[model samples]
Target: MKDGDETRQREDTPFYDHPTGGWGSLKSVARWMVKGRPSPGVLDTLRIQNKPGGHMCTSCAWAKPPNPHLAEFCENGAKATIWDLTRDRCTPDFFARHSVTELQGWSDHDLERVGRLTHPMRYDAASDHYLPCNWDEAFAGIGARLRQLDPRSVVFYASGRASLETSYLYQLFARALGHNNLPDSSNMCHETTSVALKSTIGSPVGTCVLSDFEHCEMILFFGQNTGSNSPRFLHPLQQAVRRGCKIVTFNPVRERGLIEFTSPQEPGPMLTGGSTRISDTYLQVRPGGDIAAIAGLCKHLFALDDAGGGVIDRDFIAEHTDGFASFEANIRETGWDGIEAASGLIRADLEAVAEIYARSPRSIGIYGMGLTQHVHGSQSVQMLVNLLLMRGNIGRPGTGISPVRGHSNVQGQRTVGISEKPELVPLDRLAELFGFEPPRDEGRTTVDAVQGLLDGSVRGFVSLGGNFARAIPDQGRSDGAWAGLALNVQIATKLNRSHVLVGDGTWLLPCLVRAEEDRQASGSQTVTMEDSLSHIHGSVGRRAPASGHLLSETAIVAGLAKATLAPNPRLAWDDWVGDYALIRDLIEATYPEEFKDFNARMFTPGGFYRGNPARERQWKTTSGKAGFTTPTVLSALGAEPGDAVFTLMTLRSNDQFNTTIYGFRDRLRGLEGDRMVVLMNPGEMARAGLHEGQRVTLVSAVEDGKTRALPGMRVTGYDLPDGCVAAYYPEANPLVPLGWHDVESKTPAYKGAPVRIVA
Candidate 1:
């Protein structure tokens, strides 16, 4: 029960200093399998085969390789699945023992660990506890609230966990109920990627597939922790390394995956008693400084072009790209002085990066939340595309821009009707297929939803899946905003902080997790999900329900639609839940271009890769070409020189997925049993008149006359840029203002919040 200093001391005893996913990964997997006993058989839970026949790993959105290794799933993926398949049950009886107020006092990790929800529970104000309710009664009441309230007053929030079928049904239900307020978790994480890429390459996804690593000569990582976030990704990276493909990483913190990694499944590396060095050159860029570094790369590229004839791809630029001359001029104007000052990197470092970029026949750029979670995040992504377009790195074998997604099927969710902006697709087509006029008005995003709640406009909130209260930014204000809602409904597999913090009338709907047997009236059903690379594949649940009270996400959405969109035989919401193929048929009709061979291609062992015109040199743009954009070079950290002030970026612990806490320990980071800690440089700590493991309050630099202080946070000295620090979030999310987000994407600038320590 010892906290912080004591618990961290326990984790500091290193078993091995080797790279990620070695024996360490195996040990972690084994520990989790047994940690929560009475769970599904370990092998069955891991889905040791391709989905539909089995199931997909319930973790990150890394592409499932065509010819997967003996084991495609990773230790973290196993942990994610095991966490879902827990032994203890959070039944109505368990809720009776602990009141809502009492449960609110528990930690997020403890809330998940207490057990799986066994029944649909309704919040009782008199007893101050959740009481069991039947499905019909709960659905009727929730439907009544939706019917009575103004359509705009309802906020329909979807998470990445829901299947494509469920997401489509949920979105349809919301639109049919005369509202477009579909705010999803993507608004928090990768919305910037979608916004930037769509404008640049006429696509919003990674152009490279899993096999691209084979032909790639060099891979550049900007702000991504590939080792911890996407462990399965290391297989290709390790392969590329063995093939003499150089790996260069730009991150403030030296992640284990980027350092040295031994692929545990690969016999040669794992048994050789040595680890593969992942990064040949690693540069520690300041937090939110990715744009500057990327701009530096572009500036250096132009510098090379000025010196010689061979550096610029003039033919490709003339034929396939737009705005090249202006882009080059902007890069030259920014110059190395501004780039070095903002990026925390010098001219020599950027020049070194450009040398590799110029020399390599094929190169790839990869990044995650670190790059996409900022005020200028969308522009930063376009800047990356600009760098890639310099050499025509996109639309060819082994070369492209990759925005590594954190959640499984997150991109897929957006692909299948989960959007606040209906302009993403043609409304006429949707109306023809569904027999209803789709709402055209712009809806609230995650931030907009919070504002709606605060302003008394949002009366009801429904979540498909996710810890909304914990996962979002501005938690203190958002939690307060939730209190004004008349109804709050959560359809989930497990318990989290969001369920505890609710409105006047609250309902917790216990739903089935991914790949859990979803037996419908038709017999057995399979749901499809699109991966990071947009490969749509079938994922069928094989495990029995955790409790008889559990219902599939698809069924829950269908039931809600049946109740809310009443007296509708033509739509047949009730029949669609009986068989998912009917749902797929409707989806294919709705999006014929994307889901063209919707049913046929899914039978393929891995799945079918959807059309990426950008990858094929087919630009679907206003000018019929890839557009080079002039991204405003906003300084990563806006703070002028004063004291030891630093730009703070929220980080995910090694043991977490979004807001779900697997454990209190971030073992890879050498920290344990505490979330309220900051990682800073030893030199910066000393200069600030602070010591290692010193606890201090952090105050937001961009406070609007209000004190944005996070007290009881411990500062630990480590290696980082002087004006930057890292802290694990949900804990640090409070410091990021709700309105402090990208203008284009509106994603909360979680990775680039300005803060300083107060002793």
Candidate 2:
């Protein structure tokens, strides 16, 4: 840690190029709802609990409104229901007064503000601390350590704060306790938009929904950042920029809600002093140059359809689609000097962004995890569905191809299964509706559960609500492969850093969050979810239950499937853990074509859309239609650049969400009091001898042998692009290096890696 030993003085981080949700986004949602201390009647019932017929948004799967707009939520869904309905708790005299080496010296926003994990603890190891079990001794010590391990040595994981009847009863108690391993948080963000839109739109979801953001005429976004990771997706991009639509961002950092917002709940742009304009063209684009800025907008839409200018679609590409002549000979062999030196941009700004998608005929595109956390993140979402199927933008009216998703039912916990490859549904309809026989193998995903817990074939490890060792990535080798696991549980409600990095027998159960109130025996229940424009609604939790020893994530997956299936009786687990509409009638007997009448359309008024047969253009693939891929990595995004290497990408901080930090300040990229700063680009900080706030160390440029570095960090500068830089992720996740990532959806590359700063 050189650059002047400890470094400080350059604290002027605040940048703010105007616009984003005014009153500085309602004073940063009243300073994260007065530091999650809620009251004013639980902040007036988190303002109609998620909305419409109430209770749904547990935050970011976006797509709401069967009718909303009276503060339907956004200020990070009122700072994620004031961080799980505040009223603070974390009892057992606060884990017998801290220790796990004293809550590992606090901070993950002070160990979730020392609150809410009211009961079920464990991990005693003779007072390493956390000792208050019961819930029948933490489900009979996690069912006698899942009957002394080896149901593929247990793994589980599932977060996106569960529910879809607790991720279908935690994948039906991990395939009825015989293992499927599950893995989750959509195996690190949109498992590359569900593996490149189900290999080019056969469908893997998101073929447009939320009223296609009110009849889109053009939107774009790519490698998204609208108001620091989904701020109520800036009110349908501020009502499609007040309906004159025409967004178009790109990334490499311009963000502030895509440069111009102000919808502090939009009442005529928050009572005049207006501010709508959202990116009518932004660009920046460089860290892993999103496949040379989307193959220079498909080489300017194939040179405006071979100069005839009829802008392709030639009768919906000869009825539907499939390899358009090798994707128009790989976009007429991508030229423009490797798309203007890997899309720093020029060539008339990719022909003025392909003439705003060739004079828009209802477009759309959006993206996230900055093009799926790069390494050619699933070939930059197959060049965003090859620029939304070059116009016939997947099934009509206002076009498709979104991704967004931060959580709030991570695309409905993979639509009720929470996969790690459960062979895309149907194992004889999950063994004829949950009786047994399901695990058809292949599981362990968040990077094969850290190489199945460093190869002892994953000895236990549970999770079900994130903070999995600080949202994974070689964190000092996932904190020593989760302290050489052999049982770690976590279900969680507050305390984090994966519950003091558990391991040698850990438990910490404590559930019921999504804003509390979840009962059983045919009383107060209403779970279901599946947003990111797929809908499937129903949420219901109006306060009360930050404690009473918590519970309900479907009664802790029916008390760990009745303590690991003892006397199983083909599972009843006390009448579906005392009724949750009998787990939505066994998720409509294992997904009977999109939950056929799942509880009479979840009390209507805004919760039932789940359709997407490629939004009715019905290309359900295998050559049945729509495919045209071939962006063959736009000349591997013009490879070169390594004069002391740079390309970093790791972000997620506007007062964090996603590994929930809620503080350590991001004030929308004007940072503060460090979260290991960075940003960069004052002409590559004077060609790399860096300066502003200089204290660096980054390192890693491929020596896969793992020893990555990261050190003190801090850089600053800004308006990126030249050899890029950034920083944030699970604290630059040890310079990243968990198999770099994304060779068809192994995701990771947290947005292009190859670091080097060092000073």
Candidate 3:
């Protein structure tokens, strides 16, 4: 296919884009090719086929069974299904056929072609082989190396997919082993949101629940794409629209999911060619300019309040919050000209949004990584809280702020206390429950962990679920730093780029996926997940084990703890992991108020609701109320004007998860079969004297002077704003320097890194 034709095919061409539904017919043909013939009695394998009453599918442990009557599978859920059910296996002989060095040259997809890893393997550098090793030997080797390092020198990272029991035990083991370096995926994604929310509302979670959307009169979605990113969210959004909720969107790219969505679950709507119109009004704000937009809206709202309009909730403001006087002063000082210039929005557009918010009886603001991946992410989040507070949105039905989390259990992980700096209260509880005081010193965060590896302060690394090296920024430096470690351990399901970037002593330990059942002494176990709305639900795996050698993350951590810290007199580690219930008991003992009746609540239909002081409009600040945080002089990008460098923004594809690629296709932007291309506006392309399909190197303009000249990078033209270009992460991460992170949040400014695009 021609490049243009290929781009067209990939770009926003939905399954319903074609007259006969583009992928519908092709999917049928592909199914026949694989299954020989379709039987009328044969159920659609891709659809949710199981009955509604079973425990979470033994295959991909989702919390609830699909309603046999409804659209049984979500888009990303389908991707996860195909990934798990693929009739391919990676056996010991496959490793024997190709040495580790040879396999290292293969792409992430090709490595998966060797199929699922069926046995435990250890990388031997001298022989260039990943030979099969027994579980005992693997555990012993990992334990001995971990014992060799000072506990502080070893970093334990967890991913959101890990069970609550596993996460609780992992943190317990790290504390028992004398370290607090529990840097997980949360640090990289929504740590800023948590920090901002906790400081402002006295809660680290969203105050609003999914039912709030139904009650909402107006919904303002900032920087989040619901359809492409979170398909399940489309249901609530569609329902809200049907209820006459006014939906306003602020995103750089006009996502199809935001404009119109045909329910994949509702066959009648799909057959009738009817779709839900999500956004009542769409505003494309410039990248890294969310704060300015929010500030402008607040300025407009304050103006209305001053004109005897009384849009502000004087009672709520007086009783529930502080620092309003100083906050109002900052908004007054910020001028319309500055806001317009920075946000790329006009005064009228700002007024229109403000008017909708002011007139509406109830409103909610939702945002995603787009607003939090910049240098002023925390400030931007605070601004959103400020906007909500202006109108008494909190502690009300259908009104509040929501940071749509990406992973299923990202919120749950943090709730269970997977943090680098566990608060003093939690630490006290840990000490009392576990009979040992956790190290009082704050340990490494995600960025700190990377720096520790670089400075040689960290010698060993253990990742529970995520691909840390690949998911982090500055992949070039991260690769080297990770490889330099004395021991690196990855517990994962599928093969990814991180697996190839091994340390001196590397171990790839396969573990049970969320879809698979985890059995222990406590009988069958079900893990809990916290959704974006702060609703905790149970996730029970139903699929059989993929390999007998594979261990549940809970068991793996327990085995490692036993092998490494058994000799220490800190605490009883083996007793905790012998049964996950003990771990849950400890967790409940530590956070009694939150996890009270923990086991009893798991059987509840929808699980439980985590307490949010903000929902009660009770601020948990030092002064016993919500407080507006006055941000210092804000600089969206630290780059100087007239500097010939373009800012790079890292993004995900429709066919991918955070760092896991289901395929190389980006169907939204019309990019096919390749992820190395950079998207730029036509005007910017012309300004740079570049043509379509031109390959260019991206050089970081940060102080470190890091350079990554990826050759054959197709320069595709898009509708992006001038002076900005977009590229896929992990590939484009080299363009971001380690030192160039958000000052307050310390989040890598992945969405805004100064770079010079060149041919």
Candidate 4:
């Protein structure tokens, strides 16, 4: 059938009408609770007791000995806790029973059902099996391979879980080995935000702390849902709401967190089902349209400034910023019709949002991936910075631009120089400190790393932690790229899809989890993490290692460095790894100004705060001031009328984090027992002639000629925008072409793709 005609036929089919709270959902939760040996209540108790410091609070990382006298668990935190504390364990015997070929067909949920890894294993290609390997051998093999490579070809990828000391040493080893290919997970996610913020305001990280959320009179949360993503920040949001702060949201999807959030921290009210209303004004903007929304607000503010309304902070602009005249001119030339069309919001709606923002004495703008994972993602963030600068809404209590980071120490990883492009001064300083000239050439990013693998440039792949294959877009190409590698090394706590998709040589080096104690050679080591708020705090693991075989990431890095650099040592690698203090000493020597007395500072209970230029309204741009960046006119990629195309957006399920599936249910969205279903607006469904619960095929209309026909996918009607459909990632990743990515950031445009529905 023709794609258009098939859509019509599918539309006519009856929807699978199921109750929101069915027995199936209950059974799923019950099964999740009691699937393993430990009872559900016992597991919950263990998680609570395991909370930072014997605190019942499950949300905050700062929960101390004396637990708060209230319900302290947020919904998302509960999910994370439950998933981490799962009783299931995949022992070595489990791998012995299942062959690689047999395991390949298993669903993501089914693969994870065997639970966490119990031992380190090396894949034997000849036997087509994974056998347990000694930590020393694993390190020796990895080190030997790394040493053999040109070092420039060996990419050391770090996830957010790596502590500051580990990240610092990782970067050091790469530099010492003559390569800077630190293609971290941050590159794929917040690299745009970092680039934009650094270019506009010097510092790449967020300017606001968690406590600052409480001081704001108004908060404009664009393209972010805090409750589901960063549940830890929900308490401050709840507090802000209780104190009568106006909260506004701009997103395509009406996320549950932005609608109503019950602070598991509040006692009687939480138990009685009392929840906090998050957004006072929710503006559903079209995908990739955030720049237009911010531009509209800027134009409105400029008009107000011209009318002598004092809406724009003239003093701050003149003193601390540049390019206002050009910015103003650009905004004047940007017609309201174009802004409205691009943003998919009327002038009145834009005006309403501007009115709230303009009226508030102190306001903050918080955003997430929705704003940064687009073609002009960096420019979108710049526009937000421009808006904030116009109103002088930064560097004050309760007012700043906050990008809610996904992982715990994502910001921290970047702070300690886990970057592909290391600055010359840092490298020079490293050389001065370590007695070796660091690599000068810029290295590969995540995209570059993938390309390296594809072109046979990358000889070895070493991941500190993360499921890279599944997390990256264009799964087929990514899998192929991974398969072409000469060696694959993963330091992880659990068995993931990436481990299975190995090259000729593969080694899964089991490592200590964040919840476990790391008794390093330097005694019990405490690692530091920079939270979303730029607060650098110490995270010391209190529990024993999950297994005795697991090694600390620091020790692992040290071991690899010692073994690899034995033949050609420009510097001493063994001495540094013997004590984490030496690593800190090098960090101090390299970044003296920022990390002065790193050892002493880490001993402090709360750690320390990093420098934020925005706090003082100081712009460290080339012109010594913040500069307004006017984005070029964005050309829409919407499908033509005859193309029979619909926009397909990929999303993370409520029970998943990136590619890791905790369960097959999205509780807040009311989706149960499935991740393959497509969520479309009822109007759009009718317009496309598609009915609910229709088993249809989704083919990409792009030139790549790739089609993913997800069969038996119930077409559930939802509140998405017109011409747009939403599906879970990895499952829907096949539809996204390998080359389809944001040009500036190389981030996969998972939210915007042209597709045609068929049956």
Candidate with top lDDT is 1
Clashing pairs in 2: 61-532, 90-116, 99-102, 373-751
Candidate 2: tens digits of C-alpha lDDT, residues 156-214: 88778687877888887888777777878777778888877887887777788767778
Stretches > 4 Å off in candidate 3:
1-69, 567-578, 633-635, 640-642
TM-score of 3: 0.92
lDDT of 4 at 23: 34
Over 1-759, each residue of candidate 1 has an lDDT whose tens digit, in order, gives: 113522343344222245788888888888887885547565775755344456876788887776777777887788887877777888988898999889889988889998888999998888888999999988898888888899988999988878889988888899889888988889999999988898888887889887788999999998888877888888888889998998889888777788778878778867777788888888888777777888888887777888884787888999999998898778878867778877888888888988888999799999888788888888778888988899989998999999888778888888887889888856787787777888899999999898887788889999988898888777777677666688999998888999988657799999887757889999988888888888888887777888998888888888877887767556788789998998898888888888887887775666788779899998877788999988676464434335666788888878888888888767676667778988877677778888877889988888587668899988786556778788888888888888788878899888888888899
Evaluate all candidate structures by whole-model CA lDDT and list the values in order: 0.82, 0.76, 0.73, 0.71
lDDT, ranked from best to worst: 1, 2, 3, 4
Q: Which candidate is the best by TM-score?
A: 1
Total clashing pairs for each candidate: 2, 4, 8, 5
Candidate 1: the clashing residue pairs are 19-260, 515-541
lDDT of 3 by residue, 338-457 (tens): 888778778898898899999997999888877777777888888889999989998999899888887767777777878888672388877766577779888788899888878999
